[model samples]
Target: MVRGDPIDRRLRTLVLLGLLLGLAGCAGGAHRLPYDSWRLGLFAPNYMEVWIETADAVDVQDRVFRRAMNGVAAINTPKNLKGDPRGWPTRSGAGAGKQVLGADLPRLVYVRWQSLAEPQTYEAYIVIPEATRRAMVKPETGYCPARGIWREDYRDMLTVGLAPGGIARVWLMGGCLSAIDVVRVQGTVVKKGPYGGKSGGQHRPLSATSKAYIEKYGIPYGSW
Candidate 1:
């Protein structure tokens, strides 16, 4: 497999840029950012450290993921029977509404991001776990490319699809999301794939079910 640019870098930049927009517009100005060829840059990042909190707003602590935010290692599960994989499939939080296949299987997710343009400031999110580290480590496109622009799709901060890298991917969602789904998020920024060997758009569209949820709840998700 041909190697591509690091996925982490693009993610770092996108995260920073996204936060930049939030910071710049928090006082309520809305506009667009100029440069748009999304790809990995040379900006060394600080891994936007955040306090991962649970559904009830309890902070999540760990030896790895929440702390390290790195690694592809596994932990021994509740029961370890011979041939029984003591692990769960990946999925999102119950608070994010119904479970989603391939979503990060964490109690909750927190985000911290910085960009070269806005180095001094950082933005954070205490949203549902939407992705996994492996999805970043290995993309079908090999390198992490700038997949889309962070724009508003309805009232939500949507990462609109721009293009696709010509490789098929299997996002190894951990926990209850073990069996990789047909689609996955590349980072916190955008969604990807058709599983197996098919190429897909940059992000998945809001399904009719999702629209219904939005109509009832006013937002696709609830966050703090």
Candidate 2:
């Protein structure tokens, strides 16, 4: 009921194809991997965390960051969702200055962008079934900003289907970190499909810079 018939059919076909092609081992192996392995790259349970950067380098003064943050905050607020944490970063010095005051921050700072192109400005997360380690996608999650950290709370979920190796690949669109993680995790944004679908929705072909970045980062082909 949660997923559409078309996607389920595609997954079944893919499973059958993999079995027929003698890729059952690969498929089985990926399936058998502990949920934590899939979540955190073979790390200990609860050790998985992903840091995504924008596709284009957003300047501290970019309007896109401000606008996107505003959108996110609107989605997060109790008036909407009644989230606890408050105030996302802005192009103005206020957010930047606030970030500077944080402890143990990353050396590379993230500035806002001029544009958060359609699909580029999405959120994502993961979920694990009780008997299985495979994390499935959920319908929606709450977006809460607490003490400057962004958190996705997986209250409900819906997942996208791709091959096992898909989650390993992260896309870096340009010099900036514009990439999408192809896995299901708590608080992750739903970027694809009708309900969460973008207005423009389609991605323009990658530019040379984007290609180079993807290559340099060793993005898994499944990521695209």
Candidate 3:
């Protein structure tokens, strides 16, 4: 059997060890990162009812549309928004109002909604800011490694707020219902004038919580 010099053998062993260490570092880095799929919640905070025609997640890398939501419509009715005593929009426990959106960060979200009262349809292809995506996967504030990680408490849910005049806002619902505004995407009207039935009813007054929200963060286009 042929054998290399002792120094040559040691150098080859070191190179192989270096490669293994590099691969291990990469694997560890990826393991610490969060997954691509996350839960999503939709809300209609406007007094007038809003019908969601489509809410899709677009993988811009592949240019494919993923139907993240199906058979669900958001309307700001008293009963629909009743679960949360704080008056913030909550899931109605019916239909797929809350679903999983699978896509990488900074993906495009295309939403289409119909203002039932105005009978106008609005649509927009919104993009989530890259910074916001990074924040979403960050470790919890005051985290302690000794306590271990609670995978479920990773704050992996995002809420989309819909209002009249095609004003759309995205919020990251952190632990303990702490919502942080991520981005605002303005939509353009696609169709106008009574596309279907008449107005559901007269516009109701904004809920107290909604009033506070608007006072802090005004709705787009001066829409209620």
RMSD of each: 21.6, 19.1, 16.4
**Candidate 1: lDDT of 74?**
18
Q: Which candidate, 1 or 3, has the higher TM-score?
A: 3
Q: Candidate 1 residues 1-224, lDDT tens each?
A: 11213224323443344344342222232122221211110111011111111111111111012221211111121211112111222331111111221221222222222211111212223322324322322323222124333321111111111011111112222121122332322323212221111334222233343234334434211111
lDDT of 3 by residue, 13-53 (tens): 33343334332222212323375466566766544446676
> In candidate 1, which residue pairs clash?
4-143, 88-175, 88-176, 89-175, 89-176, 89-177, 89-178, 90-176, 90-177, 90-178
| Highest-scoring model, lDDT | 3
What lDDT score is found at residue 38 in candidate 2? 11
Higher-scoring candidate on TM-score, 1 or 2: 2
Q: 1-224 in candidate 2: lDDT tens per residue?
A: 01112223313443343235442232212222211111111110010111222211111111111111111101111223222221211111111111111111011112111111122323321211221212222212333333443444321111122111213121111111122333332223334522234435543333343334333433322222
Between candidates 1 and 3, which one is better according to lDDT?
A: 3
| Two-way TM-score contest, 2 vs 3, winner | 3
lDDT of each: 0.22, 0.21, 0.51
In model 1, what lDDT does residue 29 have? 23
Collision count for each candidate, in order: 10, 23, 0
